[model samples]
Target: MGWRRSGHFASLTEDEEKKERPKVASDWTLAKWIMKYLFKDFRSLAIITLVLVGLGSVLALASPKIMQVIIDDVFNTEFIKSIDERFNLLLIMTLILLSVAIITAVISIFRTVLLYKIGYNTVKKIRTDTFTHLQKLSLKFFDTQESGRLISKVTNDCDKINELMSGGIITSLIDFLTLIGISIMLLVMNWQLALWCFLFSIPPTLLISYFFKRRARKAYRKTRKTIANVTANLSESISGVKVSKSFTREKRNIQEFRTVNQENREANMKAVAVFATTFPLFNFIASAVVGFVYFYGGWTLIFGSTAILKAVTIGEAIAFTQYVSNFFRPILNLTMFYNTFQSTMAATERVYDLNHSTSDVVEKTDAYILPEIKGHVKFEDIVFGYKENELVLSKFNLEVSPGEAIAIVGPTGSGKTTIVNLLGRFYEILEGNILIDDHNIQDVTLNSLHSQMGIVLQDPYLFSGTIAENIVYNQKDVPFDDIQVAADSVNAHEFIERMSKGYDTEVGERGSKLSLGQRQLISFARALLPNPKILILDEATSSVDPYTELLIKKALDKLLSGRTSFIIAHRLSTVRNADRIIVIKDGAIIEEGTNEDLLAKKGEYYRLYQLQFKDQENGSNGH
Candidate 1:
């Protein structure tokens, strides 16, 4: 039986074989996205940036100009006093330096605040838009994506962009302005010296930067991959702790976890090592530039000073060196910025992929919204599969009238739950259609179609909230009296009232504190409280004890009286009173009729009942 079950599990459905969506390209470029994404706010950001850059350039240029004055005229009052009555040199220097500092500080503050506002506000809007887009994605998209991966996109990927916004934009802007300022200052002092420095510097900066980026980008990719793997593994391990303990596989599990942990550490360290290597090299180049500048400028001022007319002074040379050194920092950052650009683009593609999926299953624009319904259902040549090569249900047919109960009994893999999934539109039917009240289901709005129906699943789900809250989830404005009435009708009120807080008692996550019987009752109350026109109880009473089953049967009679219901049950008694019994085998209805009619025919249903009774008899000592 176990081997057979394993074989059955290997089979995939036609729907599953639908082409998997392509992953976002790893080498995606951020340039196009940056242009498009920021274009809407470009005018404002550009105006602010230009204003800031102009201010920064003025400050950079002024630094050396002020120093030249301080060294020559402003500080050299003794030299100038012989010619004329001197103004207070110290007081003049103080005012000039103080004014420059004030302007620079103001510009820096304005740039910082505006950059932060643009970046953070853009990311916030992007996150909100992405999340809202997800809500519109058909279930098929989520079915293929791992929950952890989806969560990573929403959180980790968004977080990366947030960091980039906070510092990356401002750094780039300042670096660009500094580069411009440095170029203008160096040229004015000595064009020959500036040209030499610029030419000699490009090769090492470009070559080392290229290699460093290649290595760092590769390492970063590995780090991202490892993080995703670790998250997926951790989620699975924690979620299946029961299976781990039951099999006593804790040692093996922990060992496996250690392997993933070690790999993650290695990946992260590799990325860090690459970043560390490049930063030092970049610093070395800047130092070498300083050394060259000092060597030539010092010599030029002393001996070579005579070659040029009124050769550059000590303060002018000092200012040129400051420009040379300060300029390289932004150059280094802009050169390495490509690495972050690539990463951000890749994340964007992924987020967009999830947001813009065109669902294979979609209602037409002309689709109507289903209103209050009588629940007449028809499956006209309905067909489906989990994968392309494997068909689960083929050319199936069934008709159920309003307010009538029907049971679908089938062997495992005979498309029992698949049928239910199709009806719920969780998966699209490959061929044909399902109709309710002569209106095709595919031609109705999903929200309206689903609203008219209620489902109590085999493993019923109750979120972490009070029982009353869960029951009245969709109908929040419903009075507590109505909630109690619904609970009492389902016989859930008795056990619920036993709790200290009654309906207000917390269910814990997924109602873990409740007994199977108790959960089933609560599920019933939750389903019926909506007063849906159609109800599906898939293995509804299978979790209950005999006494609980009897109580549920009474409640079931009341609930099923006016609504069309589908009951998929294993117990023979549960289906005995169904208006019609559908005995299914190998994805086809092998036999189906009323209970007495099927018994008279001595067919599949009868044989199944006989087997259950025999098993019962054998269990009781010596029947």
Candidate 2:
């Protein structure tokens, strides 16, 4: 069988579908999106960190002074005979350095806790917002996109943001702040050496900073893209494994997956190349500065009184040099972070675009409810097209009265489902208005309108839970007695009782534990549970066995009584008893009448009924 990729996605309005994506507010920068959106109460976390980090900085700066005092005071030539003085100074320096480490760790702990809050909360909001927007999006949008890609956006891509928020951003900033404090201390002790560092390291530091960020970003982008492809391939193969096995297409699928997997590997290797390069470059710069200091400072000491420049104190000089090396190291880390930042931004853009996508059908601000809708639906001179100068539906008109049963019969591409979709307010008409009880449907709140309707699709999906839970999906607060009554009405209660665990049994994934027919009956029961005024059955019985169809037919009669219904079906016999059967072809109404009326006319509907049901009848009788 050939598969076509056509979906409602392609039929989106040219203007609405392609509107420029909405953007995050200009004031909503990276920090604000993290702090404000994720953790509104960041003040406490921020203040605690500030206090501990401030203490850490002060203690660290005080340590070398203690070192200088011990060397010049307690260990001086005059005090050398006093062992007590030496011991006291040694104890003081130990406590000072130890205090710095303790304060630093305390601050680190608080920061880590805060970072997790930022990550966890942001992900929660992001997922919620993603789902909220997802629900708002018209069915057409999802039709064209790959489900796996959507899943990745929510799962893997969001995870990258979480990782960055948890540690990447916070640690990078903290390290940067620490580097600043150390540099200032070194400058206070020796401006000449500090000046050397600032001047000599400028060129190479900037070069590596720019190079590593850009190259690493390129690698990560490729990696993310490759991973998405791999995800899509996996979802496709796994979801359709039965078809693949039956058709013997395993080798082809494997070959395709391998190609994507290799691309992901190569992309990561390229990223590693840049990642590995940063360390060597960092070492070379630090080492070169060490040589510069030794050679330059030694010449000054030999030729002049370099103590005026503090160029000969062993501990102080060592500290100054250590500060210089330590200061420049963070730039390498910052560069790598920049790469992760870029990948994160790209993922954010995709998500933001989805959230911002304009709805194809926007409700009017002054719109009112279609009051007391008698279920009289009319498509008056309707015209629609996704693209300019091309129309899928043109000049279409149909009318149905209150509580009327209409069966729409058509071939594969006859636009049978489209009519149902429009009636349910899933899409907007391009030219004409769709009046429900003489009120335009576009004027009504979607939720208010949809609540009155129940739709059961060909493939009914049940969440992983008890059968009772699935039946009460729409109204959880409903009493158990009501649920049993609905199930009993649809003849589903008998089967539920037959199960080993009754309604409490887990349906497993997608209701896999039950036979397809049983699942359909359960879906029917669920839809009818709320007693919706409107019902739509689009191939609802197509996957069920004939015996189950018979049971469903009986249940449907009881459930559909006195309700407006549109049955989109290929099984003509199911709708043979409908009050009015309409035949549609190429987006136009070809014929319409009562069942006896259409069959008597001997037109499209008659021919279709003959072609499909004739074989079933012949097989039954062995004719």
Candidate 3:
């Protein structure tokens, strides 16, 4: 078997598939897309945040200048000979520092709040839009995708984008600005000292940053991919836990999970290793630059001549060293931003891919809404398959009249379910058209086509909620009396009412609290609640006990009344009561007629009937 990768549908074996990672859009492209969302609706909030950050950075630049003023002018014996005057100047500078600190603190609070708002709001929009787009996708898209990986895209990926918006982009921008501001201030204070510092600091800093940038990015991308794999593994395991236990495969499952978790840990450690080496190198460079600034500045102050290395003041050297530290601080922050940027790029690519995916079964642009159907349906020369160049239904044709009950029977893999799946427009037929009441299904809006039809699957799925809620799902303002009537019609009311809370009883996750037979009964009632014109029961009673099947059979007439129904069953007994039995083989109808007529023909239908009936009779005789 082969699988499709990402949003594109192409069949490739595990070994034939490329081992290299799929290429994504450049970081700049993805960053621009994220920025569009960040500012699209939250423009005002983003603008305010930027202004506050810029203002804070400017204030921070002023603090170092104030320290220089106090050291050089207020306390200098040569500049301030009078004690009273120096004291006044000192007090004034202290007050100015206090004022700047207070204003910066206030700005920090506002900036933090606004950044959070922008981050969460942007993620909320992306998450909401992604889910909405997912609903528009055809079943084919979901058929090829892992539910866990899709979930990771919506949740964990969006969260990564949030980390970038909340603190990464704007903070990095401000840090870069602060670095520039410190560089300029240092040069203005004493050019000679600033020139030497830049020579030793800037080149080494850029070199180290360049080295780590590539390594960290690749490492973080791997981390994101591995975590998504972990989530997918965990989700699949949880969903199949029952099957695992039944097969006594708990140990195997645990070992599999451990392998995935270890992969995640290794990927994270690789990223950590890159980060761990980066900071120390930057610190070493910063310390070396500061040390040289102190040495060179002291040399000029103590021994140097008049013209070339102009002598500097104690206050100036102190400010220059402080500015060197300030310069490296922003470099460190920018490094952190690059780390976040890499992860965001990885996540954004996935989320964008999912949101932009093309569905295989899209309605035409001018498609019309299908009016209430009378259940007349026709499949004209249908040809289809789940994968390329593989036809499950080839040149198949069928017509169903209003109020007719159809039982389509065939051996496994004979395309029985594909017929009904095509009828429901879950997958598009490659070669022909399916019409409902003479309106081509492809020409009708999917919502309109699906609205009048109800389907019950082999494994009936009930969402976690009260029984009443699941019974009346998506049917607003349904009365209790109507629910009770629907359940009663399916013989589900007796069991429901027997429970302590009756209709209000919780079904638990996927209706795990209920027995298989009970779940099928509930599914029957749910399908009939809307009084759909067309109903499909696909292996619906296969898992039920004899007594439960009898209950369903007793209600079958009422449920099948006045509706076009397609019953796809391996159990020949279920089809015996259908209006007509269709015996299919290899995507073609071998025989189809009333049960007795088909049985009289002694054809494929008869063979299937004898096999099932004899097995049942022998089982009873053995008991």
Candidate 4:
């Protein structure tokens, strides 16, 4: 049988397809955009950091020049006649060098601290904002995106961006400045030597960088994808470990995880290989330029014509060789920056893409706040589907009066739960409107609309916190008395009090420590504590034991009184006392009446009752 799936938890959906497709080449637009928006707030800190880096670079450039001065002039016989004067001059030069080193170190340390602060703050804001946006997004968004991939975006992607900001940007700037400063100094010292070095060095530098950039970008992109896949697979496997063990699929899961991990390792190896080869190639080129300078400079000093020999001093040649090394170092840094820039741009593109995605359901600017609902609800010609051209509910219409209790019963995928989902605005209908107390749900702010409603799912979720905290979640200043009263009303207080810590007991992750029935009872109490005008119990007791079902049923009587309640149940016996029972098929009401009236009619509801509850009743009688 073909069935339409309704929730994201069923499988990875369309968004995963979009993520897997090759990202369009960003051309650094995303990098620039990140700087423009995310880092704009840290402009002052960035400016200060840049200034400090610039100062440090200038000081570093002066070191080679000082070495030239000491070699050419400080020790020259003609320059320093007295031994005492020479000693004083040497001491002064040494002090100057030491002072430069000390000051540069101080500046470097301060700048690093500032950059770190800026990077962390920027990521914190981005992560917080991304999470906030994710929360505001429609259920359709979460339905399509993988949770692990989203976690990677908030965590791993943000870290890459931080690396770019904290290290890549400022270091690249300083390297470029230092390269230019050293290049100019070399040319000024001896133009002929400088010209030859540039001729030999620049072409090879450009060629090597050009080749590596393309490969590195591809490698990093692949790494990101594979790692994300591994993370998503791991998260799914861990969450479903119980199911895997129950089905004895442990070996299969392990093999699948191994495949994903191997892919990630391969991708990372490719990226590392590119970096490993590129750095040494750059160093070889730089060293080759230095070797050429020493050979030519030494040959000129020993055997060239007098003019040539005089033109290049020992000190000048030594300084020029140092300048050549300095120049190539920045070129190498810039090459590395190319790799960093590409990876960072890819991460930034993903983050911005998520930020720009508009939610399917959005609140209007002029949407009204629903004032204290009386729980009168109406569904007008609702047509809906979870996927394209596949209608789950077709032109469905229903009206519920204030204080009425409704039981919606149908086969799987018959759209029984879809009714309440639409009522909650979890998914927008393709056509028509849902209204509460005559206020169109779409015209009312979602916050105000949801505030007055409580939902208890078949599989209820409980966070890791004390029982009291979970019961009073999001309710401001809820008194202990109210919490106790709510738990007592739902028949949860007795079991809770029997626990070692009572309400203070920790529930553990997803309330795993508690039995399913206990969790459901707490969920019911949580829903009831809010004192909502409307309550929805979607198969709340379907998975519980018979004794637990009795407890739930006793609680439901008080909970449903004076409140508009919709109960979607698979077990037909549970809905027998509902004020009205609606039998739905293919998203439309097939029968609607009081339980006895529908049973007397012997229509769809009667058939369902007979097939589900009557058989069970006969078995009990036989026993």
User: Using Cα atoms with residue i matched to residue i, what is each candidate's TM-score against the true structure?
Assistant: 0.85, 0.85, 0.90, 0.89
Give the winner by lDDT: 3
Query: Which is the winner by TM-score between candidate 1 and candidate 2?
Result: 1
lDDT of 3 by residue, 1-623 (tens): 11123312122222222333254555466667788887788888888889999999899888878888889888678883588878888999999999999999999999899988999999999999999999988889999998868987999988988888887888888898898888889888777777877887877787787678667767876887798788778877888989989999999888988998999999999989998998889888888888887787778868973554767777777777777887887988886676576456667788888888989889899999999989998899999999998888888988999999999998889998899999889988899889889999999999888889989888989999999999998898999999999999999999999999999999999998999989989998899999999999998887787788899989999999899999988888777989989988989998999999999999998887788778887884111
lDDT of 1 by residue, 52-123 (tens): 867776686676667766676645655646333335654676688889889889887887777677677767
Give residue 386's lDDT in candidate 1 (0 to 100): 77
Alpha-carbon runs more than 4 Å astray in model 3: 1-21, 80-88, 210-280, 305-308, 620-623
lDDT score of residue 239 within candidate 1: 91
lDDT of 2 by residue, 499-538 (tens): 9999898999889899988898889888888788788999
For model 4, how does the per-residue alpha-carbon lDDT over 250-332 read when each residue is reduced to its tens digit? 99999999999999999999999998998889889988988988887787777873543335776777888788877777887
The order by descending lDDT is 3, 4, 1, 2
Which residue ranges in model 2 land beyond 4 Å of their true spot? 1-69, 72-94, 218-236, 247-274, 291-297, 305-312, 363-374, 386-389, 613-623
For model 1, state the Cα shift of residue 123 in Å. Answer: 3.2
**Given candidate 3, what's the lDDT at residue 538?**
92
lDDT of 1: 0.76
**Cα distance off (Å), candidate 1, residue 366:** 3.6
Model 4 pairs whose backbones collide: none
TM-score: model 1 vs. ground truth: 0.85
After superposition on all C-alphas, the RMSD of every candidate to the true structure, in Å, is: 8.6, 7.7, 5.7, 7.2
Per-model CA lDDT versus the true structure? 0.76, 0.75, 0.85, 0.83
Among these predictions, the greatest TM-score belongs to 3
Comparison by lDDT, 1 against 2, better one: 1
